[model samples]
Target: MNKPEDAPRAFQQAWNGHDMQALGDLFHADATFVNRFGRQVRGVSAIIEMHAPIHSTIYSDSTLENELISVTPIGDDAAVLHSWSRLACGPAHPAGPHVIDTLFQAVLTRRDGAWKIIALANVTLADPRTGRAMLRV
Candidate 1:
């Protein structure tokens, strides 16, 4: 990544393309990630392993769009960022097409002059009153 803000869009683009290799390239070797479902994985290998199958299965026909929320510089080479994203499933999905809104927070660090995610977390937005996933704000 060239800038800290670029990481969120890059991540959504990778997921949309369903390319594990591309997605993995955005992270550091020891990166940590937490999915919307509360699944956590550490290390690039484990992160790829956890995500690859879903990209081929449930999320095979899913498309994602991310809107950057904020990017705060921690130093010259480190930053914390937030993004809002929506995932829309295609008709082929088993439960029928649906949309989910999520919020993501990521910590990125530049190593050897290349920016990469060191830690990330994703959470599904929900309605407190209905106890259901919120598709809109």
Candidate 2:
């Protein structure tokens, strides 16, 4: 990726396309990830393993859209990026078709002139008034 924030958009596209190979290419070999469900995983292959099944099941007809919120550079090679994502799940989802808003924070580093995610955390956005997970239209 040309910039640190580019990772989110790449992720959105890869997920929307249901391309696991493309998704795996965006992370470092020893990368870490925490999903919105609070499941934590490490390593690129592990991340792919955890995500692959979902794409064919609950997320088979899902689409993801991400908007970069901020990019904070820690150095010439390291940066932190925050993005908001809207995940529209398909009817295959256990809860049925729905739209959810999520927040993702990623720590990326430039390696070999390409930016890759080293760590990422994802959370479901909550409704402040209800203190519950928010579902959007």
Candidate 3:
């Protein structure tokens, strides 16, 4: 059985690599992805598609640092993870690295003996002057 900690680390690794498929695999089939842009995409296919552009873009370096705030088990099949992430943008986004930071929350579920994310929500925290996110690290 995989611990809840494993899922978050896997998510970070997959995201940094820009591996759309791998990242999608971390989600449940009916997963919901709420981007920082306020756009919500449901299902693994949509999630995969949403990240494809990112992977194709050159100079794109995305890093996610998550501080697990809390974890609650929902019955026996699911868990809710409240976390804050400091997201740093890469060169491809025009803002460059360390220019932006985003906070995120996620809900994960165990399905067929694997832990998958079921829902996610994120928002940007940026510098008012430059309109760029300020990274903590």
What C-alpha RMSD separates each model from the true structure? 1.1, 1.7, 2.8
By how many angstroms RMSD does model 2 differ from the true structure? 1.7
Query: What's the lDDT for all of these models?
Result: 0.93, 0.93, 0.76
Best by TM-score: 1
Q: Estimate each model's TM-score.
A: 0.95, 0.94, 0.82
- 70 in model 2: Cα distance from truth in Å? 0.4
User: For residues 12-105, could you state the per-residue lDDT of candidate 3 as single tens digits?
Assistant: 7787887888888888889899988899999999998888886677425767666777888887878877766766667766656544456767
Tens digit per residue, CA lDDT, model 1, 18-104: 999999999999999999999899999999999898888888999999999999999999999999999999876788899989999
lDDT per residue for candidate 2 within 1-137, as digits (tens), equals 89997888899999999999899999999999999999999999999999999999999999999999999999999999999999998899999988899999999999989899999999998988987988545
Off by over 4 Å in 2: 128-131, 135-137
Candidate 1 deviant stretches above 4 angstroms: none
Ranking according to TM-score, highest score first: 1, 2, 3
